[model samples]
Target: MFLKGKTALVTGSTSGIGLAYAKALAAEGANIVINGFGDADDIEAERKALETLNGAKAIYSDADLTKPEKIEEMMKQAADEFGGVDILINNAGTQHVDPVEEFPVEKWDLIIALNLSAAFHTTRLAVPYMKEKGWGRIIATASAHSKAASPFKTAYVTAKHGIAGFTKTIALELAQHGITANAISPGYVWTPLVENQIPDTMKARNMSREDVIEKVLLEGQPTKEFVTPEQVAAIALFLCRDEAAQVTGANWSVDGGWTAE
Candidate 1:
């Protein structure tokens, strides 16, 4: 219960990697504030589950990440309820994959707003409170694309690369305040969303299931295995510990050697 009195706000936590982060922090006895869009019943279930797991308060916000006003309202709610955030995980993101020439301008705007600008807004709001307390953790979910480029994902790659830079800048600014800021870069994370895409990819490519998994899905990942959300969550939790006080300003890659190459 090292984090018994801490409060963690995880964006896009209704499912996938974000949900995994909420659960991992909740297991360590941190109060949870989760946000994202999903079924009402499902969201409540996750909120209740987190509360039950650690006997800590858990709340959900349906804040639209693309809008700063909604993000402000969400942060205000967290402050009113929990006295302010102690750990902030900016993980809400959306992707639109198309060739640069055919990319939709609206999609580019949306992706930048959610994946990059939202983190900036949340960090600015969270930092004042963290500085007042002299301790905090700020973690952003970047991607292998942050370090390496791939075709047809111009917006995603740009936003992730921006996140890496944002993390480093803030880490240096808050270095002596007992706060640490870092980005976790995962490659080809295996989620239900990713799973659902495989069949369509196989059909489009006319490849066998194994070929799709290896040649298409896990091609850039040297391990030939997709990174798990739980694994990323574990690393995030580790960054919250006293042992990780000096681990700021780093983009920790959990990308199965994708970025290593």
Candidate 2:
């Protein structure tokens, strides 16, 4: 295994795309630190399942991504437990859909802190170790909103756009250091987050659930199919390959042509 002795820290990884990333990495033989909130039993199950993959070690962190101190502590724990992080995926995020003027200030701040700034914190702490090791991968779960905007998602859009820029800056800064940085932008990912947003979207647009799913959620996606978490995970796996060493400083879109228009 190419990553037999490596370690990965993936935020928001108790479920969905983030979990997929963790599993994919563990399959390649990387120890995993899965972070997020969920039922204690369920989280423990996921953590145990990850450890089963290729017999990799796996741990769980309940760190609050919105808080820099906790993020630092989480990174320290990973470094202490696994020697240091070799793969860092900043995937924790949240969304609020009120109109720009009506968006709560607290919501905007929380979204920015979790979605964009958390990556900064993790990267800053993890980079020194990566630099010393002379290799690393930093991937962020940005969204199609990073490139194209939709109405009523001002905070999410802003945060994702910020991630795009941040990824590029990190890539350039580490270009000669054997470290790669990138963001994966997915559109209409079929996850609990999207499923849960349907009712709110229906209420906001005064439409039925079906209408919200088709006309609101899938409207921008020409494929009219939700991007699967596994599909995005495959791309993340590819980026860590030796063949992908030059693929940094890029925003890889798994949006099914949402931004092609």
Error of 1 at 258 (Å): 0.9
Top candidate (TM-score) = 2
TM-score of every candidate relative to the true structure: 0.95, 0.98
* Local accuracy of candidate 2 as per-residue lDDT tens digits, 46-165: 999988879999999999999999998999899889889989999998887877788899999999999999999999999999999999999999999999998888889999999999
Model 1 clashes, total count:
0
**lDDT tens readout by residue for model 1, 59-147:** 99999989999999999999999999999999998876666787899989999999999999999999999999999999999988889
Give candidate 1's whole-model lDDT: 0.92
- Each prediction's whole-model lDDT (CA): 0.92, 0.93
**Candidate 1 off by > 4 Å:** 192-212
**What number of backbone clashes does candidate 2 have, counting pairs of residues 3 or more apart or in separate chains?**
0
RMSD of each: 1.9, 0.7
TM value for model 1: 0.95
Quote model 2's TM-score.
0.98
